[model samples]
Target: MTKRSTPSSPQSRGNAPRKSGGGWPIPTPGDVLCYAYLWAREAAQGQEEGLKDRPVVVVLAATDTGNGVRLTVAPITHSAPDGAEGAVEVPLAVKRDLGLDRERSWIVVSEVNGFLWPGPDVRPLADGSPFYGAIPDWLFLRMREGIGVHAGRGRVRVTKRTE
Candidate 1:
């Protein structure tokens, strides 16, 4: 399990609790999670975005560390940014399986982050929510490969088709 140091002064926004260990179910790889993200300000760009609650795809399986589970995830956005490199377009089948309402969405593989689950920062998608469901194993593997390639980790070569 990878260890991440806690920020000295963690930013808090919206109704998300500021501590770890909640009753929320620990999300596994392939699960789409919904949470409030306190995106850091880009001072040079003169921008301050706060409390964006949205769906993110769990790219790696959660590792329980007694206190809370650690998760690596990539953001799922309805709008695909123009010329944004390393954005993997989510297929219609996978989107339908995940119960996403958007006609199209992309997994931002380059924007992966390690977060503590059942913590103030991350939580499961609400019951009956459109963003609640798991992607198929093939899609999950493709996402993992996308992340690996984007991060300059060696590419994952898969030749088998699950169809």
Candidate 2:
């Protein structure tokens, strides 16, 4: 996957803050590809304005031997207009079972860190308590051969939403 340059140039002055938290590198293209499944859904639903400023988990899966499933989970920092950070994880046994010898193996987002923001810096507080929050217009609930995308908008507590 191609590496995305950090938004540090003077030209990026108007860009939203690079990050709200520290300790991680920006999202990679592969990370972005994992989320492509969501894009497909969002586009299909004809919704495009939502999804910014949220933590999202992208999950991908592939079939394995009988009675088992292959799964991967990734934690992604969703920035707006075009920036994100991500961390990918998979079970060692599953990896071997699925022959995941390359980085292109399946991955998914299990949780989100914060609410999806508008643009990049703004966070709208809920008018009521325990805001149910908004689901991205684009969410991949299913995958082809048990592989697809999902959007949680923040660090998902459960890495694998399902087996």
Candidate 3:
């Protein structure tokens, strides 16, 4: 667990959740959580879940019609931007603050996934912590802008989780 507001963390073995139990915290914008992010390509190929669990940044959160919070999140990966992919580098200080690996990482804004809060894809870290913690406001704003632009350009792909 992060020792923050949440009970614990999940990558879920790489993302893993059945449901939120025991007063599970609601996700907020700028939160970096380990999740099973089904990429657009995977969805196109008919794969329902992400290949592996990984850190993802919450870019948007809105109250769904069912009164559950629906979240739109982007992946954080070590891969550098190689082309038209919209991305923002994760500053070393930020990564250090979140207790993430030392490897260089980026928040990929061009791809995202949507799911209800504390859905089945959420997973705790092996130690049972629930998140890496939240990103800075400035960083999240930048990511949100990127997401908006990509989404407007039809470059963003949002895979809604089935479960």
- Model 1's lDDT to the true fold? 0.55
- The residue-by-residue lDDT of candidate 3 on 27-138, one tens digit each, is 6678888888888988899988888889999887887997588888899989888764579998998888888988999999988899888888887776665577788877
Q: Rank the candidates by TM-score, best first.
A: 3, 1, 2
TM-score of 3: 0.83
Each candidate structure's count of clashing pairs:
0, 30, 17
Q: For residues 1-163, could you state the per-residue lDDT of candidate 2 as single tens digits?
A: 2222331222222243432222112221122211212232343566543344332232333334542323333323222212122223333443343222333332334332222211122222232111111122122222211232323343334322211
TM-score of each: 0.63, 0.19, 0.83
Assess candidate 2 and give its TM-score to the true structure.
0.19
Q: Residue 84 in model 2: shift from native, Å?
A: 10
Clashes of 1: 0
Ranking by lDDT: 3, 1, 2
lDDT winner, 2 or 3: 3
Residue range 1-163, candidate 1, lDDT tens digits: 2211221111111223433344344455776767553332232244332247677777765555664567776777776756455577888876665556747888766556565565455544444222365666666677777777756854322111110
Q: In model 2, where is the ten-residue run with the lowest total lDDT?
A: 128-137
Clashing pairs in 1: none
lDDT of 2 at 108: 34
